[model samples]
Target: MEQRLASPLLQISGLTRHFGGLPALDQVSFQVAEGRVTALIGPNGAGKTTLINCLSGVLEPDSGTIIFQDRDITGLSPHQVARLGIARTFQNLRIFPRMSVLDNVLCGLTVQAGGSLLEALLRTPGLRHRERRLKLTALEALDSFGLGDKAGWPAGALSYGDKKRVEMARAFVSQPVLILLDEPVAGLNPEETAQIAALIRQMRVYGKTMLLVEHDMDLVMGVSDHVVVLDGGCRIAQGPPDEIQVNPLVLEAYLGRMSATA
Candidate 1:
């Protein structure tokens, strides 16, 4: 379990988003503690993806404030959010199929890249130095994810689990303060899921905060310090993993029936 900090690293307040007449996120509020792993688990159509999109600036909330490190970042573009030390992986693999594995991870460092476009075009010494440094860093990240041997291969040629690892390595390559993982283990087999789970814990050890959106209950409960449950675009229950497991509302949301004792 992660130790909670005095102040939250990210705060969402009164966040709401609507699609035409339907609400995707309804007055959602949550606090993500620094250096902790928080799991957002909910049934289908629960607005989890919508929330991620809004936070990452893929979509703007109709009304709300997103405070990161005490700065209001609501509606900032995706690159803007990433520059503020936030990185994320998609529910759908966003890997560049035609690119070499190393190049795919290199894309994540664009936010950190320095030197003017003219310098890059001229292949200045500074630009070349930065490029070499980035490649080494990307290779290290791939090694950490057990993909070093495959770094030269096309990302599309890898197995499904390997592709997921590549995406994750890309997200971590920049060492963001927070990572949002959407359905990280969705299509993995047991061994692959276990590997991802271990990697998640390893990231925590490296002092990374993670907000995970996943349907895998075992993985969620196993690695999360806190869990938030949403249903039909509304937050129903939130607490520590153990408490969330026994939460009546959570059970009802997932099972579509109330507990016998409830």
Candidate 2:
């Protein structure tokens, strides 16, 4: 009999992070397959954010290996990781408050821009061409998220949900291989949440892979291809949403907090 090989787009092993004497993440390990949505769920203080930070290069783990596209990117800087085609949205919106929405999205294209300040100042043909292309691509990204009309609006003036949508647009403009979303629907009303969920499904249709960290069970169950449950800085269970919904460990972790409310 032949053994099948795993084709994971992202893989982690022995991921651990400690703060002073407390462990925020402990021996965490998981694989995110290409072109599928993987949801990371856990209660407060379960290390979900810490794990994402490590993965996105916002925080370095005490020990671990992060392999993406078969490259060892562990300990890379955030910009270095972004250049490697990994983009992330924060739990709190990180948009430029005073910039126009279109300009905010244009920032994602900086890595692809031509030459340098001198070339741009001299109005070189190459720099001009790249700028034109970036603007067009930025418009298309905004259109996909239904924000084309708000291109000139100041990012600070947008509502919470629209700000989140803009952040998603900015992340997508870079054509990332994998996207990490942290509490994307947090503080949104049902209608806005549903809209964001729809946008996520649209990205899946485009074959975009994602790792989502969210507290909304309904959204997680509806969109996730695989669910990884965490508790006290450890992975308790991982499986399809259906299996995760009924897993004893998952149930126990959420029993008191979610069972009564969900």
Candidate 3:
């Protein structure tokens, strides 16, 4: 089924996380609208990745409630969250180094329903059919990211830029309703960053909801439909990209002073 862009699908309320007495996220709240690209932007230590970790179930929050599709999903395990149709890419690459790029992507399709272990051991008709379909889907996902030719190569042998794209393809293979992108464009050159930004925009055209945590201001402003700013573990501003660009508080927190770009 196709999702519409006119409604809110994820609501985060009073989300907070602490690490050894230091508050990484404090009372953070936001709504991710269906079918929109939402970027989470802030300074180096503003809790962006911590918030993402909480959302993707890599870390449990100290206090908060996460509502997705009208259900409270706070504190769910990573596997539980993935089964609920949320996919994520981490700040560090999570690829299987020795595996083929195609196989790395195919791993994401584990969510695709297959028969039980016993049935698979017997090569049941249903499981075979599902596995074949999943392979085709995984290949298509790699091709869409411009990495089809490298599908047979070792994932660890690729350049950093290509590795990032592979990670993205893996997350995208799950076909989730929401994608949590943690620093998708970090440490890339200008050309690489531009390519990724374009891919994100393409995903947006297809109505995939994205919550991206990126340090690249240009990419964030160019690809995001909405921007949320965090400072000292608190949400300081949020709105359309243009509005956030001019927000005084955002300028001060992100750049240490007011600037035209905020």
In order, the Cα lDDT scores of the candidates are 0.88, 0.87, 0.86
For model 2, give the 10-residue run with minimal summed lDDT: 112-121
Write down the TM-score of every candidate.
0.91, 0.91, 0.90
Instruction: Give residue 245's lDDT in candidate 3 (0 to 100).
Output: 87
Candidate 3 per-residue lDDT over residues 83-191, each given as its tens digit: 8889899898888889889877877776424223345335567656677878899899999999999999999999999999999998998799899999998988999
The order by descending TM-score is 1, 2, 3
Clashing residue pairs in all predictions, respectively, total 0, 0, 0
> After aligning candidate 2 to the native by TM-score, how far in Å is the CA of 106 from where it should be?
0.6
Task: Give per-residue lDDT, candidate 2, residue 260.
Answer: 55
Distance (Å) between predicted and true CA of 143, model 2?
0.5
Q: Given candidate 3, what's the lDDT at residue 35?
A: 90
Model 3 stretches with alpha carbons more than 4 Å out: 1-6, 112-129, 257-262
Q: How many clashes in candidate 1?
A: 0
Between candidates 2 and 3, name the one with more favorable lDDT.
2
Greater-TM-score candidate between 1 and 3: 1
Better of 2 and 3 by TM-score: 2
